[model samples]
Target: MIEVEVEAGAWTAALPDAEAVAARAAKAALGTVEGDVVVLLSDDAAVRALNARFRDKDRPTNVLSFPAPENAFPHLGDIVLAHGVCAEEAQVQGKTLADHLSHLVVHGVLHLLGRDHEDDAEAEEMEAEERDILAGLGVADPYAAEREGRA
Candidate 1:
């Protein structure tokens, strides 16, 4: 089973449906893992701070995932999402807010499962998995739209 503990209030409006989508993403991303994970949805300000502090990017990103520390009980890791960045990306990509958010949720979950896209090949593999999982959830292929000039 997968459990998600939300740490912020920015996603309260999308929480109900986001939880369902997040569960599906977790199931698809982790396969058979059994544990709990945390998802922190916050405004651009919080995310930007986290990004700058941890990743040294000095800017807010759509999502950031921090894996669980060694030997942690039932805690996989934490996923931090920036609401404003997500909304803007959704708008620019011509996808609904929920869909974009779902993609980011899945992306973050994949990271917790040890997935990485540090190179082109890895990114392609990860993107393919994301497309398959998101498609099963009735979300369009995020990369396909961009590749096809539909975004």
Candidate 2:
């Protein structure tokens, strides 16, 4: 089960089926693991606050994932998204807001499952997983366009 909490925002108007995105993204990566996830659709300020408090970045990021304890089955983790950041990124990346949102959710879920992109090798592996999972969700490979620029 996926729970969506719109923490003081009008996300329903922008994303009516927010929870669906969370559920699909998480399930696509979850595989055999069974657990519930909560998606917080919040504004930039909320995300920034969390980022500053937890990561000391002092800025809002696209998504933040918080994993629960090891023994928490049927309860996986929490994914938080910044609306302003995601929309701006979608516009910049040439993707629909929905598609971008789906990708972020998938990315966040993967992080909860121990995926990271802190280095080149790790990023390549994680991006491969993201590409495979997003493909299954009918989303285009996000990095394809970036590679297009180089080629």
Clashing pairs in 1: none
**Lowest summed-lDDT stretch of 10 residues in model 1?**
3-12
How well is each residue in 1-151 modelled by candidate 2, as lDDT tens digits?
7777777355566777766776677778776767888888898999999999999999999999999888897678899999989889999988987788889988888888888999999998998999998999999999998778989
* TM-score between model 2 and native: 0.91
Model 1, span 1-151: residue lDDT tens: 6665555555657555666666666676666677677776678888899999998999999999999976995788888888788878888989887888788988998898888999989998999989988888888898976677844
Whose lDDT is greatest here? 2
Residue-pair clashes per prediction, in order, are 0, 0
The whole-model C-alpha lDDT of candidate 1 against the native structure comes to: 0.80
Residue 87's lDDT within candidate 2 is: 82
The deviation in Å at residue 149 for candidate 1 is: 4.8
Q: How far is candidate 2 from the true structure (C-alpha RMSD, Å)?
A: 1.6
- For candidate 1, what's the RMSD? 2.5
